[model samples]
Target: MTRPAAPPFAASATDPIRSILMNTLIAPETDQRRPEFPTQQPRIEVVAPLAPGDEAILTPAALDFLAALHDRFAHTRHELLARRLQTRVDAANGRDPKFLPETEWIRLDPEWRVAGAAPGLEDRRVEITGPTDRKMAINALNSGARVWLADQEDATSPTWGNVIGGQRSLYDFLRGQLEYTSPEGKEYRVTAERTPTIVFRPRGWHLVEKHLRFHDRAGRSMSASGSLVDFGLYFFHNAEALIAQGSGPYFYLPKLESHLEARLWNDVFVFAQQELGLPQGTVRATVLIETIQAAFEMEEILFELREHCAGLNAGRWDYIFSIIKTFRSRGRRWVLPDRTQITMTVPFMRAYTELLVSTAHRRGAYAIGGMSAFIPDRRNPEVTERALEKVALDKRREAGDGFDGSWVAHPDLIATAKAEFDAVLGERPNQLDRLREDVEVGAADLLDIPSAGGEVSDAGVVDNIAIAIRYIESWLRGVGAAAIDHLMEDAATAEISRSQIWQWLDNNTVTAEGTRIDQTSIVASMAAAVAALPRFEGDRFDDAISVFREVALAPEFPTFLTVGAYARFF
Candidate 1:
């Protein structure tokens, strides 16, 4: 006998989004270059939404969606109404949630998107150094970065910059009171620096509690007793300070497990905002969604922090290891794919992405993809080109599949990543249209703002045209400022990420008009946008390119990066 359909109260048809997701052509349009979007009617599929700890409260929207489905079918089968609410007690099967009369709903984990602002060698053509030290920091900022993540966490000059993350320094920095020089020869501005923007990843709760000392009673300093207690302490202190400072830097919450964790974060943010005398709803969040439970609870995780969570990003290696250790014994027989392969081509990644995009788009947030850590080897131009081709294709496919942006670990790769991000975006008018429509239709939701560690910001997204122009404009600037050889270390990695995000636009960017580029330049061009930097006017660009190639492709490279590493994703 066939399994019974759900009761009348349960959705008579599949959710509209699920229907639309089917046959959704996500590939970027080769001609218009528009990424594919879902356009079909909803397809119904049976799924048990409940996981062990999942709880469900039918939101008004879910209720409305159900009503719409019931309206669509006039003479729907009588069995539907009877079986929809079938009790687990009646079935006697243990596969379903034990709780009867409760809708089975396991929220999926949210995906995270890397900001265009944070500093990294891959995103920005420059490297960021130092915590509050201006010369080193500015040198890194001026070199270029979509965003300079003011270090507090992993990239925080582990030794020197550690002090700068203190409440006072963090507060002043966020207020735009910090000063620094730009690599473009501009004198340092005193009040604050904006061009090379910053996103601060706070010290992981564990480290801050252990290492960073704070003032105590009677104005004396003391070591924290417990990391767990210190997590709450540091979070409250720094998170509140940031809110009071009025800076727009957002958050990157790491090592989470479920919606409850996100809710805990949301609770902290709410407390910080209230006590810090800050405006409400100014902050936005980027959830790492790294753990196995997080992946399963994505929908609810975001639900709690609806408006606060701006984007959900898929973390790579860290998450893979997290998954393995979570159930090593149970999954031992089912070995994971090769490390390199897992990084690029995620086998069941679609399930997660679909749930992420489906729920995020359902709730209205940007769906950002994860990182491609490979830095193209320029020694053999072919090696670099081949690596580039693989990820470019992957990113292109991701965008087509509904991701708004992706991450690259190398600064040089930032231009490539952004160019691909923009290429997939197609016309500006269309983008504006989609955003306006989505936001207007009540698509976006955030439970709280100014998420954990203050990582994601409400700062403007780099426009496709802006991203394209910079990639086409700069040439030698990056090569001279930084090295692109291998991103094994965090500094080189940070430089690459920063240059790609921070300082690519100019005062005239909004109004300037020119098509100094074409498809041919994009397709056949193997040159780094930085290679064309104004600083290197003549053979300088070529020489810099040569330097990059020599270093990047040197045979003394990592054993795995041995040759064409991009193919590993596949």
Candidate 2:
């Protein structure tokens, strides 16, 4: 297949910038090579040079499909992102978020139910999650879990290679051609009798793919939306093959803040299916209820995507980060304790999960639980024993609380998580019949932040700084998910770590040892943390510290660390 020609650019003094916190500015004008214009029609130009394997994924037809999707929905996506900023400002200015009065009818009319699970998604007892690198994709497919969350969102670093290579990985996975060989002569391939169902997660709408620039009809040029690029490429290339294999083009939508966003996605699905001549409802999507704003509009979101909705996943890590980010400017009462202190058993988290289960089940959707980030280590039997015990307890609680399935980061914990769900759902694909009508959650329950009562210790504050620095360094090296201190750390956990630092500094939080969390103390802790880490070749500690300070210690807060980091470093 021939590659698409680079599109022409109108002369400009500077590169265009979408919202800073959302789409972010792309590469500066002087650094890019200009190609001659082919035609006046709206076009997409590949700014980054194609790498070794990118030819397989970035064919001319695939780029055309991406341009079509962006042209149809880019305007609405921008409007929705602007609305998100306004909503955040309102929350900071004491306009508390309550259930929408206008949408009360949607909630009151209980007859509506989402399109249930598709063929392979009927029983998702154990779902494994990881980035879509070739090795991880192979391991996840052969992990014996019912589903593999081929994550490109929080779990991916968004390097130019990863962004395109991930799609290539999935394209190869569906064709049974994914395999990896280590330098030590160990070979890894998909060898399981029954592979897991594949659920691809594209990046959130807030991100922009700077490697590709889109020129609209009016001759305005900006970076392409990451969400559209990821979804467009994957669906355009693999939708037909997946459907023929009895698995539709299923997805897990991340970081949706409102029902309107869900509605926008529904429109995208409708338009894409029509463009491809597929059935209207051939796509299935599971929305991650990761934001506080989304938790309030669960039923409304379900209603909007009813035709293509699969269920909701409790994105617990991002949910915590959302709480801190939404209420960062508020008084100390809205401040949460250390991340270690906030468990699912806390009144507020419990309220959120219970409400999620009841809300999803009431609307005839599967209710999936949060991830257990603990990865068992065989080198130390004691560590493995403790990790398994902790994972078992967490899974048991989720299964007993009416969750159909739960997520595990590593393959070792799949059996434990599946065992818990299996004990509760014997000979049954799911527990959609167990509608937890008893879960009555009010606005006050979800906002009960003070109910999570635990003192902030000096250790907690220091750990936040350490984890943020470590994870940011790994991200800078193009690795999104890193095993840190025996736990799987991703962008969500790193967001929580950095957000807590900002929240603590804003609120003058005093640790249990009478030490105040101020700029001085945080800087000292960061320096110490860096010194403690073992140095490796090509490590990004210096850049990581600079990025961490800009996001965590600055006077103004960035909505997402990845947004700015990606724009600047990647």
The number of the candidate with the highest lDDT is 2
> Model 2 off-target regions past 4 Å?
1-42
- Model 1 TM-score (2 dp): 0.47
* TM-scores, all models, native as reference: 0.47, 0.93
- Give lDDT per model, in order: 0.38, 0.88
Per-residue lDDT of candidate 1, residues 391-439 (tens digit): 6776776666666666554445555666666775754311211232222
Global lDDT for candidate 2? Answer: 0.88
Instruction: Score residue 239 of candidate 2 by CA lDDT.
Output: 97
Model 1, C-alpha of 358: deviation from truth (Å): 2.2
Alpha-carbon shift of residue 215 in model 1 (angstroms): 10
The C-alpha stretches of model 1 lying farther than 4 A from their native spots are 1-140, 143-151, 154-197, 205-208, 212-249, 376-387, 427-485, 488-570
